[model samples]
Target: MNRIKTDWTKPQKLSLVALLFIIGKTIKESWVLILYFIVRAFVKQNEDEDDTEKRSDKLIYFLLLTAAFLIFFQIQKFIQFFKTRIYIKDNELIEQTGIFTKKTKTIPIHKIQSVHLVQNYIHRFTDTCTMKVETAGTEKTELELSAIDYLKAQDLQEILQQKEAVSAANISDNNSTQLMGLSNFDLIKLAISENHIRTLSLIFAFAMSRLDDLRQFFGKKTDAIIDEQVNQINFTTSIVAGMIGLGIAITLAFSVIRVLLRYNDMQLTANQKGFKVKWGFLQTQQKMMLQNKVQLISWNSNFVRKLLGIKILRFFMVGENILKDDQYIKLPVLQEDVLKKLSAYYQPVWPSLNENPNYTHPSYAWRVTMIYILPVAFAASVALYFWEPWVMIIPILLFLYFLVTFKIRHMKFIFWYNQTSLQIQKGIWGDEHILLNFKKVQHVALETSPFLRRKNLATLVLHTAGDSIKIPYIPLTKAQAIADRCLYEIELDKS
Candidate 1:
């Protein structure tokens, strides 16, 4: 396949921002015009004469505004023509641009961590996409190829994947497997257990609610019409109409339908080689994740999903911000059971679960309540003596709430270590479970506060390849021993 290149026009790239400016100006001006007309119509005498003159003046102002916009558009096009040409080579990508001074950047392929293809509404309609390539070696060395043909984006992805495979092969790791398509059973489990229908319903509702805002910004000037309609409804009638039982039912039904339509033939497959994700309704996207580049795995679930035994799994590659939160890849809908089974295939060296009876820390709730309630109680008692005696009851009630909330949510924190791995667990609800291999650990630190030192206790912090894990409130000697052992393990692995 031919490699990808991007040559974006200035006006094409800045069209969205231009539209935003126009919409903002139009709204402000229209509001002023409305107030002027209202004053002329109701507050002033000889309203007919003023209204006719104001209408003619408004037409002239609009014509002048259009001419100014056209002048700005021409200037933008001229700047774009001077600064636009990006080229991608077999092992390097380069961007060349300049108005007065030329600038060029060449990025090596080996350093790249991930490649992404993104499309907005306009891009989708125009059959174009933007490609972003990120590297691991440097922080600011990002390559953006904008306004490329959709096929060019896919071709670019494939090129990067092949380059990475060759680089891995050069390093002598032969384990590689192409991802197989997701099974029908797996999809059904993902749909039901992950609450895909519910999630889709929420997305649809959120999108629909934004319609009014979107119309205000993007549609013609119609604020007065909308406001008039809104004001016409009686308060009692509006309250009755606001009953959302029917809306909820419709949302749920439509959400399930949307999920089915969107993921009609969804598939996810991965092996030691790389991961492949393919799905869509109107526009399809294919994402690749090299196995060796995988950095972290995280799982989350809300209260309802937890009750239903569902969890969402996300994977972070070494450097890619695949999602807004910096996650590299995610399985949006996956049953906990299905995820467990899939983990074995994707993560062959999954860390072993560690069980430790001796390791424990105070619950977060206990800490939060104790931190807040103690001071409040002391202050309230002193105030009660000088002020209203009822002040004592206020503090008492606050302390009671704190105590109850802490007791209900506080749970034992545990950290465990085995020959090859370390595990940390905490939280009463939505428990966080972290597993890290010993080899992945970069360093270890032992910390002790004045209180901890007085109690003969300290905290052990484990710094891994990607992130850090801490086990707080352990015996001081034990914490020191753990830190030393981890440091020794790191040295041993390197040796």
Candidate 2:
């Protein structure tokens, strides 16, 4: 450590755009203190002030304190940013951070799982992007270069991608292919056909959660405030209908806007290294994952998508990645033929869709009915006895829904496996098909309760690095056979 003379490149490596992030972080971290001071200053000034000079003096003091607090944090962050350095040295991506307590991190190029370059609305105008580097064992992005030149980011991504490809191989690791991209008309269609119901439900949930938050502030008065607001609205048929229409219109508008913003100019590409997905309008994102790291591939379609011959595809990569609940990449496939090609690329020897899958036991239907429908019906009936007849409507509707969907949900729960891969098909209105390479199976679990054992049925759970697929209410023999086959494939892969 004798004064290592190397090109550190801290000045060129840093971006002024990162000051925006630094300011945002400072505000986020110090918001409570900021708010507390402002509120205190206001309250003190308003407390029956006798002299204008005293009130002005108190206000000035408080303002000075707040400004000094914020300025101190801002200066600290600026200093840290100035001191931070990242560079490539000896086949490793190195980052040195911190001013007082210095730290250095070296990540081998081969260990990099993904490198994402993102440009939000602000970054786009600045010609800079945030590059996030993720590794296998880490739960979140391990290294994030707040802002870098777009060309420099691309070069870094290429170098990392080339390094990753050296150790990873896929079936179609040959030519660079533009698998799919959304056209203008297709983007409009996707936006229009977006699931407004799901969006509305999310909006509703968020509103309700906020209401609970309001309850914390308002105490018992929260309900009274809501009731007071509700009472002002005249409940005429026309008014009710207009409100419903307005809600639907709002939901549709929100969905369309969200879909457009998220998927505008979306493109999916395949290369010798892996797959890359680029999308978003206001905030552009480019994610690259290695082909060999993919453990499971799935595609699903709602009723609208099915009618339109469109499906949403998802790739599940290997690792203990728990951060992908909402962050998972979703690629839209417009053509069934394209989907087939993608599937073939992932699993060359997949089981045919026409093959008769091992369906769940017939008892699954009754068991579901007993577990779900009966309790709901009983609870509804009890509520009807205690309350008004209107209460029965919800339960009655739920019961009817269960009755209508019981057969499809239970009887259609089927799975088929070949020597190389396993495919599970399950859903009620929509169809979700998950394909897993047998060699990727990390473990097999066969679970049975006393009731299931008595009925000679067991649940087979195939655990992979990405997720778990549970095939329940199948014959014990079939369950065991599938587990055994998966273990055999796993051992074969090891060999």
Candidate 3:
């Protein structure tokens, strides 16, 4: 193989500079020494009028030092600009970095799971993109060929995909088709249907923690402002009101912005070889996934998304796929007809398909409440009895929660299996449908607690490279039969 040498595009130097500036501002260092020096300076001076002037000079000095650090960081980036390089060698993907003390990393070809082509805003202007490779190995990203020419990066992606395909099994001449994609109207639908609670919680948690840090920096009580505000209403009301305000704030701007940036012009396509998912606005990312490597396929949406009649589909793969979007192979806002197309394409792949799955047995509902709810409620009641009689109300609410969950969710769970796939359906806010390709099963086991044993029931645990699924309170004998069948199919596939 010929040696291929590449480095970051010229515009990446500016990117590096901006990154350093952000990092410098974010670094936390105690200002005790500076405070001490200011106090000492003021105390030593007999003139009261001059103290304020002296403090201003100290503040100016602090700003000057911060400016100096930023400049130094940018200079360091320039010095390391020429030292980073990535190349391909026989049976190995290699990266060489650092200047004086050279650091080299080598990842075997078979270990590489996915290669994503990424192009950020800077890269768009420079006609360059980053090729990020993820492997089944320990490192998060096996290799990142940062800021290479856009077209060259794509050719390299094809090369890596071909290598992986050869290792898994050679691909046939199967025609590729665009399976599904989001239009501009669909993008707006996704934005409106986005679940912003997760984002809101993260932002609120982060802001509260930062406020604590800032309070210490200025020597103020962190809860002092909160205590004064709490005089207006009860704690519960304050919390509920605050969450409502923040949820609206996040949903309007942050959630919409996140959805737009990640899923803009989203597309999903597949051929006989596997599937390819591409999306993004300022930075485009391409994730190539082989069907054999797919461990779990789940389709779910929140209550908001359900009202919009859309769902987000995600496929869990064996190894890391280094895309900016969290879900490695995510399909955006798919509805009915498209779901039918996906089911037809995938369900027909190995063998028999059973669209009507057997619902969970009637006994599972109450049994689940005993295993999941009763003990927790008992403990909460006991703990609250000593401290607050009013907290006894919590146990009553929890029992009601258990009753609802049992009736609505646990009893409605469905499970089915055939030669090719195992389908699991269970969710509350929105229907979650999981389709697991039987050949991808890594291991299978059955678990039984004393209670389950007494009841002649067992939980079937199905393991895959990415995650596990469990079906609780099935007959022990039946669970064993299903496990045996799954094992038999895996053997057949291997042969």
Listed in order, each prediction's TM-score against the native is 0.63, 0.83, 0.75
1-495 per-residue lDDT for model 3 (tens digits): 964533322222222333433344334232444465668668864546777878877876886687577668655444544565555677566666667778888877677667777777767777776667777764376666656666666655655666666767787645778888888888888877776777777778989999888888766665777668778766598889997787697666877787888789888877655677888887788876666566677788778777888877777767644354453756765577777566554555322243456665566777668766888888898899899988978997988787787877865588777656778778865778787777777789999888788888888999887678898888887788878887987788779
The top-ranked prediction according to lDDT is 2
Candidate 1 local distance difference test against the native: 0.60
Tens-digit per-residue lDDT, 12-105, candidate 1: 2322333433455555655655565567569754436877789867875885586567657655534543465555565676666656667777
Each prediction's total of clashing residue pairs, residues at least 3 apart in sequence or on different chains, is 2, 0, 0
Ranking by lDDT: 2, 3, 1
| Cα deviation of 345, candidate 3, in Å | 5.3
Candidate 2 lDDT over 123-192, as tens digits, reads 8889999998887766778888888777777767866776667745423244778888888888777876
Lowest summed lDDT over 10 consecutive residues: which window, candidate 1?
7-16
CA lDDT scores, all candidates in order: 0.60, 0.80, 0.70
Cα-based RMSD of the predictions, in order? Answer: 8.4, 5.4, 6.8
RMSD, model 2, all Cα superposed?
A: 5.4
True-structure lDDT of candidate 3: 0.70
Candidate 2 stretches greater than 4 Å from native: 1-12, 27-70, 170-174, 202-241, 320-326, 353-355, 371-376, 379-383, 386-397
